[model samples]
Target: MTEQVVTGGGRRGASSAVERVVATVREGVKTGRYVPGQRLVEADLMRELGVGRNALREALSRLRSDGFVQIEAHRGASIRRLTREDVAQLYELREVLEGLAARLAAQRIGETDHRQRLVAALESMHEVARTAELPAYMDENIRFHRTIVELSAHPRLEELVDQLQIQTFRIQFRSAAANHDRTGMREYSVTEHQSLAEAILDGDGTRAEDLMRRHLRHTRSGIMQLPDGDFA
Candidate 1:
């Protein structure tokens, strides 16, 4: 019994370590610290994350299943890069999913404190945009969308959107950062966000859904304009 207890505790500890490594790497990818196609050296990860070899490998495996990492037999692990078709298909799904989320959120905006949360999220985006910090703006942009999905009050919908958003994080960050020099583009995004927020707050479900879909379509168009070298 003593030996079994020790083994169980050890397993839990390793699992915790792996989770930490996974979260760190995911955040790095989302924030553009790790670019697509950049190799993830096992030794470096092990050192930086302060985990054992086994824990790091386990974390890499988890990230691979999450579509964030690609592991080649000989070349080892690198951040996954999406193809043009992949980007298109992802946006197509996002348009449907997020549009529905916005509609539902609008209908349910008065429930609980969702309205306040969403308003705060939108204000954060505006604050970040005013500073012209692309990274901060992108972070708040993600938070704003997440707020909408949370306001939808649908567990399964939130789960699906979260998965899709995770897969698209690096792509979104790269695309936005690449166009940071274009002030008009950033201003346009802020305007669209404000419009979407108003529709949701007003409980106009149809308008909210329409605006969300159009917003996603515009984002997709911008990503499509990126050079081919950015895609697989």
Candidate 2:
């Protein structure tokens, strides 16, 4: 059953209903309230989200498109599970795409404001990491990376990165959960991000690209090292 209920009756209620239902399920998957391979029973979702069957199904469809849920004929819907091989494949593409974004961002980031935003993103990440808030930290981490992609001034590149960011975060979260030393991993993340920010700010495209690739490689290794059940 859903932990919270979102209801509808007003003029904007119908549209908002789907949005609320989607948000609930998306947040659940992100926070591990819904783990990988867990089936999302339609009736339970309808009651938990306080939405009708149609609205719940629509929400699940949206989640499925976002790579958060998988629906099969007869199997219904469940949180999408990632295999270690999936992790490797995703990271291989991420390293190339993100490395390119970082390089372009280094070349295009001439404005002081953009540089400051990168710094601010890193600062927010540090604050959340220090508090040991994994979800918040993950949000900030993605923000930091997305900011770089935005500053890259490559619209196509940003679109591509956006496509993979969510799934990548899903795997990363599970890996951190499986790791014995999450605190240490978080600390390591902060340091690496700070360094990447500095590299980009310094206008070193080559260094920025290399740093991004290396950082993603490390993340890939971390995820691959986790046991099978972590992502299951």
Best by TM-score: 1
lDDT of each: 0.89, 0.82
Q: Lowest summed-lDDT stretch of 10 residues in model 2? A: 1-10
Candidate 2 Cα deviation (angstroms), residue 213: 1.3
Report the lDDT of model 1 for residue 115. 88
* Error in Å for residue 95 of model 2: 1.6
Candidate 2 wrongly placed segments (more than 4 Å): 1-24, 44-62, 131-136, 154-156, 181-184
Cand. 1 Cα-lDDT? 0.89
Positional deviation of residue 58's Cα in model 1 after best superposition, in angstroms = 2.3
Q: List model 1 lDDT by residue over 1-232, tens digit each.
A: 9988999999999999899988888888877788889999989888877899999999999999877899999999998999999889999999999999999999999998988998899888888888857767777888889899999999999978887787787788778878857578778999999999999999999999999999999999989988998899
Cα error, candidate 1, residue 111 (Å): 1.7
For every candidate in turn, the CA RMSD to the true structure comes to 2.2, 6.6
| Model 1: residue 4 alpha-carbon error in angstroms | 5.9
